[model samples]
Target: MAFYDDGSFHQATGVSRETLDKLRAYAALLEKWQRSINLVSSATLPELWRRHFADSAQLAPLIGTETSTLRCVDLGSGAGFPGLVLAIMGIGQWTLIDSDRRKLTFLQEAARITRTSVTLLPARLEQVTGLTADIVTARACASLETLLGYATPLLEPSGKALFLKGRDAAREIDEARKTWNFEVRRIPSQTDPEASIVEIRNVSST
Candidate 1:
């Protein structure tokens, strides 16, 4: 099933009209910014709703019902994928981190246009400090081992890390386990059959 527009996006995700409007504005801004800043892949522009919006929106349900009080931090949030999208969905208080100034600029503008409030951190993941979150998210940011290293210090005890991974998820998990010990639950991706959402917790260095 392909999501080509807002109606289809709403049907697929069941977001409210207000949220849909925010997403529409966000999409327009993304398209405009993509022309100069390379916010997303040019090939995926035609399927923006499916490739980006819906894909990011799918993370909402997995976060459970109590989102208002949760703090979510997105590592390497290049174009704000699940982070900004979740903020617009009213999922949680969000902090998005990215090293690129230009991408951070785009995210700031997108959040302004979408009327979604988020904290933007312009720094590499390792340089980020003095912050913690109930949830940490990343998409196409780095290898599982690297992401785990980035997330471990930022995550509160009992917090969870949700990573969007493609077909190499199992292998990545295996490799990650070699350096760290964590419990992982693999949730099937709503947007792509071959992809998966890897939910991890109880992180400790081995």
Candidate 2:
């Protein structure tokens, strides 16, 4: 359960040696940045491989095999958990959005250190426009309703939204259904049993 090193991470995710090296550099940067920026919760730092790396990597399998051509928008990408990690894993073309200038700075450096190309947007999710994506992703970003509001406008007609939700996923889904109509598939989280990866598509207003 404790993935304290890159070996454990590769064992769990099956990343190639080259990808694993990049992740190592990425993790090193995260640790160094956390000293001043509070990139991630300090408690979870000890388990960075499993808590952030693997947690983000798990989405790759669910994304299917067309990653190279897909455009993904990540909302509120604080420390770029699912977004930067996914990009490093070669999942898709990623655009990470966040309002904090400091965090955006960190993402810029992280992307460079990991050799992962990603667009860093220094703006609120609601302020973004004129950009559409094949997929939208967020983790600990917002409630299900608000996330849908942010995702719907940017999502291509055939696109899907992948949200990592905590224990209240079912409750949030029920509440979201009050104002939105969408087909959802709930996949259990590989990292946390109490969490779930919510995949939504064919969305429309109620």
Candidate 3:
């Protein structure tokens, strides 16, 4: 309810009432299920709107209205942050990849409830095969270099990546630059100004 209104979430993603309602339902479900399963950081639950939902939704702009039609993959989809957010934003296709079946179950249910089209894959990102996407995203997935290793093989040429990272972003980028040649920019995060987003494209290995 009040959550959808906070965190620059609606502003970042331009969420419609239909989608916003679904995300609201998702929040409720997350709170309910989280009591049993470790979906999100418990300490972050009190501020779930700004901490989780809004943080996830802020990446919607990177999807761009044009890219919304492209196939996308969300690796290590723990709590379906930007991945599920992207689904609500009307991405043509989305696959939530994770090693945990339980999380996949939640993702699938979230997709169904939200009426957002999504595919759930219960497997390690490195082992998933025979698929490629126009965009690959991961929030709290892994280090940038390791993330590239997991995401690059599945990305189509001209594909882009949106990763969420904290204060150590520059160090992560430096490590990523050791083996990857891509244009990476850090955008100020709407949730926390001290935080930033790592946007990577023109992916190449050094």
Predicted structure 2, TM vs. truth: 0.97
lDDT of 3 by residue, 1-206 (tens): 24434444565556687777887888888888899899998999888878777887777777777765688898898889878877876764888888988888888888778778888888887798888988888888889999999888988888888898888889999988889998988998878766788988888888
Stretches of candidate 3 off by over 4 Å are 1-13
Span of 10 residues, lowest total lDDT, candidate 1: 1-10
What C-alpha lDDT values do all the predictions have?
Answer: 0.92, 0.92, 0.82
Q: Against the correct fold, how does model 1 do in TM-score?
A: 0.97
Pick by lDDT: 2 or 3, better one:
2
Off by over 4 Å in 2: none
All models, RMSD in angstroms: 0.9, 1.1, 2.4
Worst 10 residues of 3 by lDDT: 1-10
Error of 1 at 166 (Å): 0.5
Instruction: Name the TM-score of candidate 3.
Output: 0.92
Q: What is the lDDT of residue 126 in candidate 1?
A: 86
Q: Over the full model, what C-alpha lDDT does candidate 3 score relative to the true structure?
A: 0.82
